[model samples]
Target: MPSISHKIQPCLWFDSQAEQAARYYTGIFPGSSISSVSLYTEAGQEIHGRPPGSVMVVAFELAGCRFTALNGGPIFKFTEAVSLIINCDNQDEIDYYWHHLGEGGDPAAQQCGWLKDKYGLSWQIVPAVISDMMRDTESGKAQRVMTALLRMRKIDFAELQRAYRG
Candidate 1:
């Protein structure tokens, strides 16, 4: 068998909603899809001779990244230690995703930018110029932008630029 190149896979554990979540994610993002799904069966010896046919796993992709959702019976849950950062070009894009992803989610109060979805998934909705502002070598401009961003949950590009000017 040929060895596959290295790829990052985010393994997600769900009680039984892996498929539903996968479809929801694919719908929310462009260029996203759920590739495949595999179910489980009691092919081997069971705890008490139980029959097979339980959902074992679901493998899919979201925004070009592969993820595996396992039906592990709710032993674990998701946390904020890991999150997806989306860099947006405008408020419309930010609002669209923020609203969609946050359908059953939570908002972290960084208006215009940071929000935690109902699933406890943390996302950073930022503007395109943020990179330039943060990476700028000019200390004064960078400092100003940084200060402005520190106070915002949702990143506002216009305010960041105003801060950069100061």
Candidate 2:
């Protein structure tokens, strides 16, 4: 309905799954949408190797952040160095995102709420309170939370709460 006002937008590189990834992400987050799409023309066919009228880039938004999914012919891949973080208010939210985002993902790559999704995108599903606890270093809550967090893949919210209290 309105224009994307964000100055900086993340452009994800996909081989040929740009549209698929855009749809998958839009379906998961509320108030998200695929705002626009651009098709490749024959002008750059020799270099890009994509056919005319094929999907080239899909612009979308998640959590109010605009993103561009580019069918860049597998030139780049997602790594753990950078990830999208999803902050949840509670355990159910964590579980909900963890299940959905981690589907068909690399199980071994999952650690401390960080997961690599089916599309090779990395995501961090964490509870909001964990950050607060992790920053409460004066009370030793940060240490306890870090200890508990390091042992978890999908974060245990209740366990973190217990750690925070101790």
Candidate 3:
């Protein structure tokens, strides 16, 4: 198979924590690292107001997925509408991501395996089984799973499995 180069990458906007967020994310996931860092230049100082030589953008990879974190000032902030989904194979993976990502996060924002990380980036730490369980359209198993899923903050794979069986 030919190696596919990714054309589109998600760019995360941060007030000034692009480098910090990149470092945090690289530390959390395996096979992740900061590939490059671009500093702000004097040419755009008036509009950007950021000091020259300060971090402007950080290109990083988390678990093989490329991402760009931009220190674009406080013009915009993260919302829950867009979230990065982490599909885990089992409960252990779920717990690990939940614990790590939820640190310094808004507790109220955590629902149905969805959470806002410290940088205000939304994430869904879900189990792989949830997708299989949700695919059962013939019976009301999917509905049951959905009901069970709606009640929880962090996803419980066992509960979803039980809901699927019912």
TM-score of each: 0.80, 0.95, 0.95
Off by over 4 Å in 1: 1-6, 43-51, 108-112
Candidate 1's TM-score: 0.80
In order of listing, the candidates' clash counts read: 12, 0, 0
Q: Give a tens-digit lDDT track for model 3, residues 55-162.
A: 999999999899999999999999998999999999999999999999999999999999999889999999976788888888999999999999999999999889
In order, what is each prediction's RMSD in angstroms? 3.3, 1.5, 2.8
Candidate 3 regions exceeding 4 Å error are 1-4
Tens-place lDDT digits, model 2, residues 79-161: 99999999999999999999999999899999999999999899999998766888889989999999999999999999999
| Candidate 2 TM-score versus the reference | 0.95
What candidate 2 gets wrong by more than 4 Å, as runs, is 1-4
- The best candidate by lDDT is 3
Could you tell me how far off, in angstroms, the CA of residue 11 lies in candidate 2 after the best superposition?
0.5
TM value for model 3: 0.95
